[model samples]
Target: MKKITVLIVLASFFSCTSTKIIVDRPIVFNDEREALTLEYLENRYGLVQNTPTIVPKMIVLHWTVIPTFEKSFEAFDNPTLPNWRPEIKDISGLNVSSQFMIDRDGTIYRLLPETTMARHVIGLNHCAIGIENVGGTEKLPLTKAQLKSNIWLVRYLKDKYDIDYLIGHYEYTLFENHPLWLERDDGYRTKKTDPGQYFMQKVRDAVSDLNFKPLPNED
Candidate 1:
């Protein structure tokens, strides 16, 4: 009897948490940062065009420790990274900015228009749509409102762009061995824990219809 009771409790707990674990769709809030353009996308980040060009295949989620939408907007607009983003220097003159930024109140801002190669992630810019969320501190973990907005955005992008994969920023390294890996320095990789794993799962579940590319089988 005790065993059965424990199992039931576990199932209940999991059921309650499951909904919070992953996003069901992409965010679709108003593009507060629409003025940001493709030229800024290129110059802010010294990105070189890859031959054959990359397709819009992945949607990556991120978080800006910096609070507020305007601050995040300014951060993406500038070509130089603030002293905070040491990761920016490794990519040469290339700055770190996503195609989209989600504010604290679940406001979605478009720093750059869709399909344009922004320097949000190295090697995957040609193909990935970056979405950065504001406020990632323990006290300010992403909110449920943000999660719902993310789902809306995912669905919107999936319909609009030929998006294949939806992932969190931390999973970027997992693609190192995959065909998408294009950096000259294969050894050069950054460690990240943005937008949280649980948060990503929520996004993936919401946009599962997009059908992410299957990771190649091990050699």
Candidate 2:
């Protein structure tokens, strides 16, 4: 029975590799305290805490769209929020960054600590693990090795954290009606297609045994 259970888990893990977020490196935190301000956390992630806040809920996936992992890392390494992301920066001192980045070859780079919110998604950062992939072009598609790494990372995160939902960046807007999408009302929105749909489904299926929360307004 134990061997059967292991086989079942392995099979599920393989089936869901397509949409996993691979963390190729160790996670690092920003020394700048401004990045951890409550105002910033509430603004970037819709996290409201009259007290110390710690809630681990979802995992959000993305693609750098940028060509290389180093460039992606450099963009995230900054302590100051980039002007391009000012709308969000204004809301929270927290600059935009992800906890993890996966390269074209599937090498994962940990940009920030999972516990410290590194502004990645507009309304879900407080409770989501944002995993950024290196590139999103047909010429250099996300690879098999990367997919395997993603599975490993997802399994680890699911076991370690109370992660409930897993979604691609493109699906964020869909969550606008959910409780998590409570960012300031600048009417800010971005249409994104990263880490692809087919990729995501595989990941979802792989971790299906974990019994994720029902998506808002599901049949």
Candidate 3:
């Protein structure tokens, strides 16, 4: 009877610990967005899936340089790429997005499906999931609550997917030679420093037991 009681208690504990994600679909999802996403997969990454979806192998953490959740959501909410980024216009007009967004208070919001492709990271988007936190600027730094939230989200994803790596946005370039890094245009890469190294280290340390591969060595 004691053993059964212990098992019940453990189950209850786990149930309480699981993270709850709120769903907030992007304002636009249509044939245009679908086509642009597919074009990006094929033209940029050389991946031609029958559908606009990916089998995630990595999770990339980022920070919205944009300070507020409303603005960040508004930026990614548009399906078409804004006119400001003319450099990537030739590739596709699809605006960059992520699978999930976490607010300053550590509330997790799902902007897109985990399997659906969102143009967050450059090279590895074909098989990587992106998590964008609300802020990364000096005035609105990321918080401990956000850190804990990211740790929980990473663990949750690792449990459900065959996730092999966890990397910061700045580390995306390190995967240039990796088989998963498939961007066709050599000049298409963008420099990034997001969610910061210190924040990523804290997350990595928390999930060290997951045994994900270390970031590829810098050349």
**Cα lDDT of model 3 by residue, 1-219, tens digit:** 111111111111133655355545454668889988998888887777778999999999999988888899888888899997787777778898999889899877777878999999888988999999998999989999899789888888888899999999999999988988898888887788997999999999988988998778665
Compose the digit string of candidate 1's lDDT tens values, residues 103-178.
7776666665566556666556667888889888888898887887687677666766777677788777767757
Q: What TM-score does each of the candidates earn? A: 0.71, 0.75, 0.89
* Each prediction's whole-model lDDT (CA): 0.63, 0.66, 0.84
Residue-level lDDT for 7 in candidate 1: 10
Ten contiguous residues with the weakest lDDT in model 1: 1-10
lDDT score for residue 13 of model 2: 51
Highest TM-score model number: 3
Candidate number with the higher TM-score (1 or 2): 2
lDDT of 3 at 127: 92
What does the lDDT come to for candidate 2?
Answer: 0.66
Candidate 2 structure quality by residue, lDDT tens digits, 1-219: 111111112323544533433343433343464436466665555556653234668888877777887777777766666788655665655556777777767565666566656567766666778888787788877777667666667777787888878788877776777877666664777667878987877777767777887676543
